[model samples]
Target chain A: MDRSMFVSISYFLTHLGLIFFMYPTDIIASTDEAYWIPITLGIIIHFIFLSIYMKGLSYFPRKNIIMIYLSHGKIIAWIFLLPVAIYLIMIIIITIRSYSEIITIVFLSNTPLWAIMFLLVLVATYLSSRGLDSILRSSLLLAILFLPLTLFVCFVSFQNVDWRYIFPLTTNDFRFITKPSYLMSYFSIGGVFLFIGFIQPLFTYKPKKILYTVLLLVPFWIISVYIPILTFGNSTVPHFYFPFVEAVDSIDINWLMFDRVTVFFLLSLITFIILFLSLILWMFMQIITTCIPKFRPNYLLILISFISFVCCLFIPDWKDVEDLFLINSPFRFFCLLIVPPSLLILGIRSKRKEKLENG
Target chain B: MGNTMIKVFFLLCIVLTSTGCWNNKDINHRLLPAVVGISKNGDKYKLILELPVLESDNMKIQIIKATGKSIADAVDWLSMNMDRGVDLFHVKLIVLDKQFAKQGLTDVMSGLMRSREVAPNAQMAICNEDLDYFFGNVQKSKPPTGDYLLDFFEKDAGWTPNIALTRVWQVYRSLHSSTRDVIIPIIQTGKLTEVEHIGSAVIKNGKMVSQISPNDTLLYNAFDGQGTQGIVEVMDLATVLILSDWKSNKSMIINEKPFMKSQLNLKVTILETKGNPSMDLIKKDLSTLITNRFHRMLTITQKKQADILGLGQTFRTKLPRAKLKNWREKYYPILKLDFQVNVDIQNEGFLKSD
Candidate 1:
């Protein structure tokens, strides 16, 4: 498969899957009646970040972000790459832990948390070890299979929705549009664009194509945030942990073989997160390999997976996992802000230098 | 030798970790209840569970009764006494006695919502008669009729336009949605039939406030924008009209106070009549009849402070965020509704009449 296809698939899975668990809570906490305010603002910021990130990737054609940064200097490279590596690792840890918490809470109440986490990390590590091509191939296959089913579940959930819940749109406080939770939602929605920089070496993609894909996915993010609010109004959204999952659970597909479509929906999400965890694991491994230069890739993979597994075991419960997410927010911002612009400037400068030397 | 050892270790790991399926229960070892009935007994709850036993050429229903302080406790007690583990996953009907519903179902509803075993779409109804008596009578049928209750609520099966179909999720949503309330059908054990649809119990703020007759339920369904087929008998005109299609459009005007406007377009077929009545005359009388009935239902619901028609939803579109806080209590009753009913007579019957 072409590299651009891989980038799109990986990006789509990363953004769509992880947000399924957290976006509803984030949007509800950010705004009172006007969830659309934060959602609209989040999409705008998403596009801006996408353009900057894509422009930076365009500068280093066929070279990943790690390679581009290494060209500047080892010190500059470490400064740029270390935070991203940490951010990726933190995301993997938080996503696996939180989604495991959800699985335990909703489906497998009797299953131990460590067992779920262990199974998740085990699959992700195996997939990560297979390298980028296999990850992309399997991701594409999974996306092809599950994306339509997920959309159908979203469509069926609308049967019980009260559209009036989203009304009185003008009554929003407007100040919440800039709050930290609202800003953090952009990470949930468009933060996947960071992967485009990392995977630039694998394929050459038209910035326009990537931009279109991001635009196409904006409605999905909107649906993810707004559907729960529309189905269960603002008052009820705060009480539930995974409102979207609950919304899906509330759908009744009597004609279908399965009585609870929520199980199917959760299965699709679990598949996506498995791929997402693998993609993040691969990215973290890629960064570690670039920095260390001589470490055996397989050993590094095992070491990182072990560290993640042990850390996951000690993280007592959801409260501690939530605190870890809060702690990682600044690092998340740092990568989202600094990586793209710095790389874009370096890419532009390097191009100018090459032109001068040629001239 | 090393490769074989590695393969053996992998197989061992797979076998060891696959014990995660320990919680899985076999189908034969579980008794899946088809319906659950709850009644308030002092501070405790009396639960009656009905499950069908299928033998060769004959099907019978088994009833289990238990009491505890809460629904879960009652179920736990029942589970302890059962030969097989009791599962509510296949429960299609949940009957709460009207007296129990009147006492508020907030705790019961929350428990049901939180349970993974209960299907969110299970039909919830209010029973007008004692649940024990109803279940006893139901279980007495030659080849038990308990299983028919599921089909009775199904849209394609026994359900008619006159019946209000309320699901567990709808009940939950209404309990949480400030502008919306639920109408659960009230059922009674019938002398001639297995079970009879009495009317509908209007629930507001987690309690039953009023009950509407089945005829009024048709009007309520119409006003609520559910296109249920209904029959309207005009005694003076010596005619019967059947509503084939129903549509309602609701909007609000936000001035000093909110005013709601609901426009109903109903397509009707003249099912039977003693004498021929002009379409124009039938339309006029039908409009008046529906309009009057809807007004009466609305008045009753408003007086009871139950927004069963969900009129507050229309007002919600225009009300600011803060006003919605006490919408059901302070603003909903004061809001005025203007109803416009238009009846379109499509067919007079198999025979065309003037």
Candidate 2:
């Protein structure tokens, strides 16, 4: 119940990896100027869901998110758990596949793509198979080992920021809320919030603590979009699939042994992504075993990893990777729609039941 | 203890495999080009890569030339022919032929960016002489000085205000921005020197529409907020070095006609005064000199409707999204640019004050 520190640090680490890659391009694609509007909107929506989900979990003490939903009925479980399960699988595929593609583009051109993907899948599955205690402990280690490097990279990546592109500061248009790129920005904001509701058995975290951690994430959300825009301006930023990587590639700081800071940025984010993938895999396996209740946890993890590797191999190229992500938006929407409010309603109903017994 | 050992072994296996360095090549096996000379070869593109010879103790130079359908193709052909892979990561200079630039650099720049080989900040320049002679004589007679051109344009090294500094990303930005144009410095092969810094080419929509003198480039650099190392010789009065406190204010008005005013404030140190000129006379002379130079430069740009000074960037905020597309044709030619220069003498040199 008292492991809030690990919860918060892992929260920060997971979201840090989410912002650098596709998030910047999506946000910049969503709006021309004053990107802060869309950014804050996405964060606020995710924040509300997080608070509600945590509050609901507080109602059922000692029960994890899976058992809480699965205890009700098969219909309730399918309605609540299926959306998140599918979303987790979709993200697992995209993150590993695209991350391998970026590594190929940045430094590992000679290495075949599947080789990288296989390596990523192997590491994540291994970590998740060790179960929850190992995941938490390893996350604490990875955070301490990698957080400073990530911060330094983020700070120095701002070197080429030219404020002149900060022009046309007031768009006065909220229609960006409807832009596909804007709505899909939930890909960054809501990535880690779902994991919190599932963490009840291992530890308890107040929604306020998670909210404060999210407050720190606002700067990352803003910088991820602004650094590329300020450096390249609106006209050139869209040409980039990964704007932050190109923006950092343009930085020419000598005295450092690393010539391409893009490589440094890529490698650091890769570690974070792998850690994040492991966390996702753990929760993913948690759901699968809960559904059947007959399969061994290790066999389910092996099955999931094997299927993920096969799906990743089937993803032919970058275009398909993008299409698959866009196609998964419906599942993402369902997860957002069904996960929190159901927990909250059921939690209130259960509380009434307990009150009747006591009175 | 046995379980811990097995875990450690597994950890070792994962780290070793995941780094993707399984087929790692040593640094010496890679050839990093310092300068790439891009020119036209009949209907195809010719790229000349200038790399440092790896085995040479004195750092001798080597050149590889190839022609293909495009820049990346030529680079690929060169790499296939060479013993080592050619990485453009360290390529610091890209020299384009003047005739090639006149054909519009939009395609070449977009190609370079798309390939993702060259770093975005790699400096871009135009060569008036044919690249064969430029890369040939320059690398041959120069005794393989090992990227002397990079030192030549590098800001903290031997850079001057008269040399306009343009990068690949800046040109790409200008090509995409509806209202913006850019100035890429022009150079030629020098008999004694590696290359001569001649003014700069005023590019509108990736084609050179006009050219400005070295002194004009100084003002362009100052106005573009690039650097304040401008050393101007004001007729027979004095030679003033513009120091780092350079400031400017731009105001614009739009209605039937577009009008814009830029006020430049400069701090200077007097290097040499002809006949010990008065303080007022020195300030007046410096002001008039830069004023006339910028006026001449502005006239050429306005006639060609090139926004090399980036004045259109200010107007970008004023115009809506749709109108911005026709900024150069509809607004730039009619826009008026006026300059006001104020000089403050920070140091009077070694001599006493007048």
Candidate 3:
């Protein structure tokens, strides 16, 4: 469980790949002509809330989030944990399909979607079954390997930046930005829920090391959002199907050995996304294993994989996938905001009460 | 052991299947279209894909030409003839003939933007003569022609400043905007057979309304600072100061009548002084003289109401709640633009040529 902090942090970063789906170019394009404000606002709000999530982590040290929740009371925790468990599964299912969708559309257009999903799920299930430790080790390996490629794509794209498009960087529609729904979308740090399980172990580490690790992640988030704006301009950026991939695609080093960089980056990024899927799947499995302690985790893994397969088969289209994601997003945010904060307050209060009685 | 063998078989399949890309094309086989020229012949749009054909002798020096379709129904119609696939992934320049540009090019513009193949950053331009001529002759000068043209549009050389490096995506944005305006560089090859970027063409409602020369483009770019570099010849000066960098500011005022003031500041470094102009004394003199000259240039750009600097967008972003409905009608017409050039003779080469 102490080693789970390492897994929790890796799981946290893996789930950060959820930003891929959240970068909805279609929604952004339809609503706003320029994407700079929303992306900038999203990053700033993300930074603020990511810090909050990391802070919340310290309160729960080393145990799985469900363990911490159980301390509150079976009845209240069950009510709360049910929605969180559902949300985690839903994220896993959506992430599974989104990756399949990208690989199918961009690279393997002729390949069957089921085949892609099956291949991805097989890898994820194996990783999840290995338990969190190996998954975290692989994730750290992936992070070390892929970070340079991501940065290289961004740097290469800088040469192609047409600043004229972003110039006169003004929009008269403050009302559009101030909309409650938009701000909600801006604060959608979807994967920070994984951190609830992390706080327990991370608390043992020095505050400075934790802060430094978090600070390192800040630039990655900024660069992730920033490159798309610089490459596609604010207005056109939203039109891209996958704005990040499209952003990388726009980087054409005429002299470079590679011609279509987006394709290369997309293929490489899929591995990271698979790791992302594995994190969510791991969390879902953890909930099941904890709730039904007598059931073997291997049998549970098969059941989860089967359920995910069925979900992928029926989700039907991007529109349906999007609808499910949208419907689930607010509910998921509700789970993230309410569950951990509530547990922290209640658990601490109960602890204080017991201490007083003993005294 | 049976279960272990089955699991091992599945793992092997996953590893083998996901390793190599099935559709990946080698760089050599793929025809990378750097400049896609589309022209309108009657109702049909002729698609000309200028793809690089690497030389058998040297990779650096390559040949480029149109793959197919002298007059295809659409640009995508020409994709059938290519071996691997024609991708505009590196397409930095989209050249339109003057005649094609004169007629509304909304369809071709939309086609380039909508197609996933065409890059969003690929610049849009209008050539004075046949675009084929420009594409053909571009390589004849020195290095590989396609790369040379790409460099020109890339603004690596500080030669063509203010030649609005408007991309296909930018055109889509401008066309969709309420203003219904966009700017594209107007290029004309000189008598010496060298490509000369003359100025920028202003389009209103997808039709060419006015043209601003390269000198005026300098003033426009200085205000916009697309980080574009170009040489601006001060009124009577024999030499031109290469503008390395530029900065601009704009404001909207709500008085009796709404007005916008735009200021463009250019940092001009002396590239060469042709006549015996004292480097020490004339440097100060040139700064004042250029400032006045730049002001005159801005006065013309303002009168023309070329929003290349995106003053309209600035207002839209900064003061989102403000009523900007009639910016073109009321504010832009009466908008005042001021230009100030600060000249510094950074490198005065050995023996100032007189």
Candidate 4:
């Protein structure tokens, strides 16, 4: 049974959740005018790699990414996926640490950070161990409950935007491409597409459908960065760490009982992030269990989550969180840039070998 | 049996989590301040918070004050002393003393940005008097404590074009922006009323450089394309209220020396006229009056070299992005304005005919 609809919905949710946090700050810090240039370029690169990743996976029907890699040789699989495994763990540690810090600052100032981290890890581990079916079903339910509210927040985020800030539509400097901040924006893009390769036979998805998904995503990417610039120009956008969060906070709808719509917007995004964490954990388990087949999988899941929780506890402050992102960017490029085209080549070779044998 | 075990575990978590004070706390045990004030004396900073205690639905405010080296330090001192935790989430207003406004707010503003304890959208104003005096007098005229001082600038409540309704984020933007400056309303305690909005304090490059009369603030608001419906009392011809929005045309020429032409258009309803004057005559007199106000505003902004009118924003299209960094200094000084005003009379009152 294929759950492509559910897979696509979760893919959209994960990407949307990641965009609002740090992507806007990085994009704005990278360029002054015509932000669309950098944003579109990033998406084009992501689209090319994603199309390749999916096409490569399609060569081996009904098999996940780890299994497909291991079919060649255990050394080959381990060599390719050890960094993938490390990057996945880094993603968990950073996301958990950073999001918990945000929650403490935003609404729960009195609470200890460890408690929030524990709660997040516990909930994410519960669904991760329940397996992919539970993850997919819960995501469908989450999108149904939270999608409308999210769409409503996105619409109202423009309430404070000044179209005048959209002036100087074209700027001369595309040197933003070489800046470290520009590549950091890719961290947001690479995360949501990785799971697409992992969800394989359980949910049959078309690579070309990523074009439609990206078309739908263009407005979100634009709004996430542009809302801050359009509300408070490029000069002012750099002052914020999460410019989109502040932009959403600037929206004033008095008739609503809630004093801050940011709280509501954040609550929904946090749920999406949790759903994403489960998927990442599930992916991590799939990789490790394939490498060492003797260990019981459920206990392994609990152990990885425990290690993640302890690692999150060690991040001293927000500055360390940012430094960790800089360190992770290299792994991100390897996973996003190198792995895809290489996989497609491998798939082509495997297919040619099979045809020769049959003939 | 497994289902019941899961049920008990969930209930136990709720029971254990409810007792934690770090985040989840009872409303009665938490302090939600509506307005926070900051002023500096010598090397120390004084932080003022107006907390509204809910006494059986009838609301009133309690004033709390602390002194420290920074905002966080002051808050720490105060929070340590109080039984309840302080939450800046509901803060609707932040008032800075005149002295604090001059000394520059970049440090304090960035501190707020980094911590993000307070929402950047909170309405901000400069107090003409001491903050202690301002809040002490403010308490005597208390109405409801939850959003007491916020009503003075809330667009729906007491806001008029004469009052420059600036926010923390706008001020922070002005601090960083190369060409744009923000004006925040300057307020003082009133004798008959609760508080009086005197005028607006012009903030340039993160510091208060000059003050403009409230009339000029109305023009500033209209130029920014907000609160354009403010009433204007023109001398000897008529008293008219702006009935339509602002329609402006600005053209910038970027030669060796950049120059600009600015046009202001307003449609007004004739509330009172001197006599049965010709429509053309009335329009001419109104045009002259508005042109004169614009001239006064321009003379002040140009002389001070502060781009409070946001003319630089219009010229952003004319300058390259790299050259825009020095816009206020290099370009703004040598820039010239060819100003024009156009007034359209929408209608006459019942008693008058042209």
Candidate 5:
């Protein structure tokens, strides 16, 4: 089987699952009764943004986003690449810290934070070292196996869901969804890490398969976020730090082998997220390799991993990690708003210039 | 190259072993405590664990009770005796015997919430019966002990509406929050020593003050659909009506005072009716009667200040700025309610007089 197909499929599925896996925790803070508005808002905006991403992808078919910038010549590309590099590093740091905190809270209460971060970083480095193609391929395998399991677990979880909390759909306070800029933060956050670099290589697969990949992702997003809201109610869901994991916690499988589903789901979802973070790092390494050709990709992986491991140590707890993600979300949004459109425009202009030269 | 690979493999093995898996909890040896009943035994508290024991190839039930100043220490006492690891992850039902529930459950509840293993959605109950009999009556057709209890709480029965599915998380929130008090399902075994869900115990400030029967439980859940459904009988002079397919919508309104209006909208697929009545007349009369009864029930809820209807939450949302300082004091007592019953009494089935 071709590895490229795996990466292409994985890239789409992982990107879809990763977005849900990243921020669906916001639904947990939606109290038992007050959870509906943000959930509705999340569903609407996810589709809108997904469409925008597809449109953006359409603009530049066979070129990496950075190369589109470089088409403007070395000067503008260098300026744009500087912020892009910083933003990528910041995202890696936050992902490491967040993953570390999850392990500490759920599975490893006794384990040191640095140890958890180290273990994850080690796996991440190995996956990232395999390059973007392998990372994407692995993601595809992981998604193919896990997405169905996730859906199965979700279907099984419907047994315990009390629909009462969801009724009388009303927004208690708009502040939960909007105030402090949470809506913008929630809509266009985290998943854009995939759109960073090596775009030209990604679309090597057939375009026809891309829609199927995106279609496969819609259920993952809806089930992960909306199911929690439906079960917990808007009032109660927002209180949980990790809503999807909390949704698994609500599973009361009477005679199932495993008593608590939280542990099982967390272990599996964390595996997918680790693959995702690794892909981000691998893609970032690919970008750096583009910049400095002499630096071996393996060395870049180790370098990013070391830096991420060290950064995870600095964060005291999950709250600080959340605060960091919330505060730096604007930077991530800037990447979304700027990177694609800028590259598309540059790609268009470069195309026109080439046509004129050919004429 | 083969030698180097072997050396690396050994090194990886060492590292793997060194990084101990904290979550490696053995299921066979682990004593799974399903429902824990904590009650006051004079000054100290009595902690009861319903453990599933395997003896002579047949599963047996074990009740272990320990007295301690706090819940954690009480569990510590059980830990000393148990041969295996005591895990509460499977602990779904927690019943506080009436004496403990009435005096206060603040201390016991806080401890349950503190444990990381305890599930947030664990169904909590309060009972007036002796904790020992309650334990004896917890027999099930299922082999594993907890499976029977799990099905017991989750079963669709006539009195299930009166049983509040209170989780540890909800208990913690209600205990801390000013908006709403906690309501726990009241379980009482019948004369045959079979477990029966009698009603619900309403707790204010961790103390069980009042109880509501199954019919009133349906009335309460009409606003909040958290519990199971069965037949509800509402009769007038002419005919006896069996109300099935019960569903209701609850809304919070903040006018001069924050009041929650609940519309118990049910598609009354009437199972059986005694009187030979026309469907249209039955619908109209039933609608009016339901409107009156539900209106009275709402008044009663308003009078009791049972904000389980989430009137405080409504005010907190719709009128955030004008939200009362204390929902219990300002809004709950003076709140006005409107009840509208749109009973779509469907055509009679087998019971219809042709």
Candidate 6:
């Protein structure tokens, strides 16, 4: 697949999975009334960070962050790249644990949690082992198949929506825009833009294409957050664990074969989440292999999967998963803050150095 | 060879463990209840599970009754007693006795909301008569296909524009929505029909606050935007088949009192008439009749403080959070309503003009 196809599909899976599973809870927890306030702020911050990241990547065409960092010095690069690698691994663990908890609660009440987690990690590991090209290829295929189905589900879910719930578009406290939960939403929405750097080397980097992909994703983010608040009022959104999923469940598609379209919705979302997990795992493997060039990618994947599996087991419950997010927030912000600018500066330096050498 | 053998073993293990369904419950061993009637007896709850059964010749239903301190307990007791486990996944109709609804359905509503098995769109109604008597009558007069109770609320089959179709999630939303209330259709066993639509039980804060007759339910549906293909008879002046759409300006404020002005556009086809009333006169009569009836319904709801039309939700847009919090108590009753009804007579059937 081409870079545009890869970038768009990867971006779609990453953001859509996050929106479906995590964004509703985060948005409801963050703001009181007029969720659009925090959402708009989040989107602005996302675009700012994305433009900088894309500009940095544009400096070094066909070179990933690992390559750029490696040029600085291997030891210094290890210090920088190790944290990024750990962040990717942590994201994989957290996503797997959180989604498994949702699956257990919503779909499979009787099935053991570890079984679901194991199955998810297993599939993600297999896809990741096949390499990034395979992951991107499968994403394109899955997006083609499931994106329309997911959008149609969202469209039909408007049947029972009470638009009045979105009213009182003003809030008493404007400071909610800076709240921790609101900031945390950036992790789900914009934080995934960091992966763009990792995949930059795979194809010629085009800033406009990537910018367009990010722009296209903003409405999806807004819809995923607000639909639940619109369907079940702000007063009620905080009560459910996965309000968006429940909102989809609340839709009554009478003429459709299935009484509840939520199952179809979950299946599509789960596919995206799996692909997202695969992308994360692939990123982690890339970091590891880049650092230790002698290590086999297959062995490194098994090692990463094993470690993630063990880490997933330790997450006893959803609250612990939440605490994990709180603990990881600073690290998430650190990577989100540090990697883009560092890459931008490096990209600039590399370009100047290249001009000097060529001249 | 060893690596291939290990992979084969793992594949076989996965295939063995993951075969069949995720949570496999055999269909033959599960009882799919079509209608569940809940009534309160002191602190305990009486549950009647109506399951449709197929005999050699005709369709019949098996009614199972159980009692417990809570709905869950009753369900567990029923599950234990039946040869086939009771599954409420397919439950289409949830009938609550008048006493149960009056006492407050907060607990039952919360329980149903928490359960994954119960579909959110399952239709809910309030039985005017005792549930025991209703279920007994339903058993005695078993209609063919055995979906007698389900068909009553099924829009495709038995539902009319007059019947208020309140789903479980709608009831839950109403309970949570500060400005909104729900109208559950009140039903009873009829002499001629299997079930009768008596009126609607107006629920405020999860309890039945007031009742509206079926005649008022038509206007209620019209105001709430569900009225289509409904018949409106104005005394003996004219019988008109009416379809209505309404738009309301909820931002109107007059001297610290919230004001709502609604304009209802009614498309009418005059079906029959007692006198040779001109189309203009018939339109005027319908306008008067609907305006009066709507005002009467509004007055009743205001007296009861039940915002069944969700008029408070409209005012919610203008009010800040604090004022919105107190809207139902402070602003709702004092709110003034101005109704403007516009009737457009589409056609008078074969007689093009009267």
Which run of 10 residues does model 6 chain A get worst, by summed lDDT? A200-209
lDDT of 4 by residue, A1-359 (tens): 66777777888888888999889988988887899999989888888888888888888888887887788888878778988888998999999999899888776776899888888787788778788999989989999999898999999998878777888888678899888888888878888677877877676766666657777887898889889998888888887778888989888888888888888889899999999899999998988898778988877877899999999999999999988988998888889997888788889999999999999
Q: How accurate locally is residue A129 in candidate 3, as Cα lDDT from 0 to 100?
A: 71
- Candidate 1, A257-341: lDDT as tens digits: 8888888888788888888888888888888887787977777887898898888887888888767877787788787777778
Q: Best by TM-score, which number?
A: 6
- C-alpha positional error of residue B10 in candidate 4 after TM-score superposition, expressed in Å: 8.3
Using lDDT as the yardstick, the better of models 4 and 6 is 4
Q: Can you write out model 6's per-residue Cα lDDT over B1-354, one digit (the tens) per residue?
A: 644654565466456545535666889989889899999989999999998888987788778999999888988998898777778888888999998899999888888888777887889999999898988889889455578788787778788888998988788877777788889999999988878989999999899999998888887788778756799897778899985566565466677789888888889898988868888889898899989998999899988888898887787667766777777788888888888889999888887664
Q: Chain B TM-score of all predictions, in order?
A: 0.94, 0.93, 0.76, 0.90, 0.82, 0.96
Question: How much DockQ does model 6 earn?
Answer: 0.57
lDDT of 1 at A331: 83
RMSD of model 4 against the true structure? 2.8
CA-only RMSD, every prediction: 2.3, 2.4, 5.3, 2.8, 5.8, 2.1
Error of 6 at A153 (Å): 0.6
lDDT for B77 in candidate 6 is 96
Ranking by DockQ: 6, 1, 2, 4, 5, 3
Against the true structure, what is each candidate's TM-score? 0.95, 0.95, 0.79, 0.92, 0.76, 0.95
Q: Judge the docking of candidate 1 as incorrect, acceptable, medium or high.
A: medium
DockQ of each: 0.56, 0.55, 0.18, 0.49, 0.19, 0.57
Query: Could you tell me the TM-score of candidate 2?
Result: 0.95
For residues A111-204, write the lDDT of model 5, one tens digit per residue: 7777677777777777776566667667767777776766667677675455533444564566665444353335324454345345454545
**Order of the predicted models by lDDT, top scorer first:** 4, 2, 6, 1, 5, 3
- Model 5's alpha-carbon lDDT is 0.64
